[model samples]
Target: MKLLLTSGGITNDSIHAALEDLLGMPVGEADALVVPTAQWGHPMCGPASVRGLVAATPSFRHFTALPWASLGVLELTALPTVGKDRWVPWVEAADVLLVDGGDATYLAHWLRESGLAALLPELHGTVWVGMSAGSMALTPRIGQDFVEWAGAPDDRTLGVVDFSIFPHLGAFPGNSLEHAERWAADLDNPAYALDEQSALTVVDGVVDVVSEGEWHLLRS
Candidate 1:
């Protein structure tokens, strides 16, 4: 499976270029799957803003939020709300899975509660794109120190990779690289802090930098 794990949105030219490379020619080109970790189809969200972020241009496939997943049962629905008619098909017919940015803790819980957490790795044979919390949520643990939210955190994760990802690296002070370094030092694990415009692409378990932004690996 081709995985494009990004720090945040496709806000940089290098990131965009890599994304285009992942999407080959049309027709045989892969379908797209969009999972929003932040806001579900909110107007202001990056996933909702881009043209191919969720679906094909001029037309698309959309699947509205499925029933809350909590354990053993899987919920299936053909109903289309909002743009599901345009969004659902893409999901059903995609060669790619795009995970948008949002609250990492909430997103991780939702995926676990819904049981989609187990199906992530099987999404190979196609491109798997994750941005911001989408990317961080795939790790064994997430950086929750800076986020302010309610409810308990679910340690359940996709485990596609074994690292804690911190988004908005240098974008702010709360979750900056320095903070990540300190946190990682305390935990004594390899941690990566990605800037808003940066991304880390992992293909077949191998990882490499994708953008011009900087990333710091904390030391204990």
Candidate 2:
């Protein structure tokens, strides 16, 4: 799988171009499956927020709002109940997975429970476009500072990637670079602090940054 992890979504021309390069085609020619599962686990998100995201409202323009050949929702929360036979094809058939942001632990838990984590190794060409906690779910740890779901055992996640991520740098009052420095101190691995216009791409184990704004790689 190819990973395009973002603090915000595709917020700039450079990131958008990188996404197309990863897709191996134009965005308008690709099919996408939107994953809003993480939203359900967050206290600040509910039906309305998820609706806004899925519907591609202006507030979520950085994410699901993009134009694609086809767009569908793959709710991870509902995957287990329906059986993998049905859902697997849906995932396999899509060109990209637009994973939205929310609680990383919760999203990680459901990814495992839904068997998607196990299935990842087989998705040779799938592009996983993740934003915020969607991106964090792939890292080793999110740092307890980013944990919002009370049900999470700890800050641990899938660790599909070696590093951690501090998303939305400076987007919120508490997400400044100084705040990211504080968060990185407690983490044992390398990490990146990404601003809204930045993103990181991992393809075949090689990583590269795609940014038009600001980003920092905080080495462990």
Over 150-187, each residue of candidate 2 has an lDDT whose tens digit, in order, gives: 99999999999999999998899999999999999999
Which candidate achieves the best TM-score against the true structure? 2
All-Cα superposition RMSD per candidate:
8.2, 0.8
TM-score, cand. 1 vs. native? 0.68
Number of clashes in every candidate structure?
14, 0
Candidate 1 lDDT, 1-220, residue by residue in tens: 6666776555667876666566553323344445644443233445444434333333222111211111111111112223445533444456656676555566666676554555556655566667776686677666446333355354434566766677788777577666777767644346677776677777777777776777665531
lDDT of each: 0.56, 0.93
Using lDDT as the measure, the top candidate is: 2
